[model samples]
Target: MKPRISMITLGVANMAKAIDFYQNGLGFPRHGEGEQVAFFNLNGSWLGLYPKDALAEDAMVDSNASGFNAFSLAHNVGSEAEVEQVIQQAINAGATVTKTPRPTDWGGYSGYFKDPDGHLWEVAHNPHFWIGPEDTPK
Candidate 1:
């Protein structure tokens, strides 16, 4: 099978609030119109937001389950400075800093934050890894 994720769908409790946080706070460009869902384009894939109950129904799961979802979304930048900058930006956008930017054991710098809905995100600068499209190895 091909190794690629077309989108990451976040089950948010409040659609409008989530949309505002991602669109206005983090400066993620949202496309389409409606109150039920929102879509934001990322570097290669997409970020989707939908009502938690609705998403759970679609997945045939109970929405009452909580706590860490056992996964985190990561945003990799080009340098240590960018890691700091991105983390600060997320914090300004109503994110809670779970970990302040610092040197990592992986020989890079990284940090983490929780979005308004408590979805964890990691912001990192891996000097040895080129994550962005322009620098990604062929």
Candidate 2:
């Protein structure tokens, strides 16, 4: 329920390649990355890269087939329990659960779902980050 976006993630095909493009080619500072995704701090939020098709699936739409799959957005909270709570809230609000909450190798707890419009959203708690209200997009 923040008034502004806390993070924005882009679904990409290749994680390493996306990382290289953002970290090297674009000179963006990446904080963490793995086989599945890559994230970069952008002002007060984040930019993420994930597999395109997988993202579509998360949104419950066929990537091979199509209509408008609205953009997936994120809202970060302060704790892991908050992540779980938000996921539940999302579900009760009519979002579909795409992935169960779990511990991640990048040292955080996270879960995924799709909004009413079928946009993918991730509720996560990254201990390494200290995203505050001051972290607003420029």
lDDT per residue for candidate 2 within 20-72, as digits (tens), equals 65566546588865668778887666777777788888999766755556555
lDDT of 1 by residue, 1-138 (tens): 989999999999889889999998989988898878999999789999999999999999999998878999999989999999989888888899999999999899999999999999999999888588887666
Each candidate structure's TM-score, on Cα atoms with residue i matched to residue i, is 0.96, 0.48
For lDDT, the strongest prediction is 1
Clashes of 1: 0
Model 2 TM-score (2 dp):
0.48
Candidate 1 local Cα displacement, residue 4, angstroms = 0.4
Error of 2 at 69 (Å): 5.9
Best by TM-score: 1
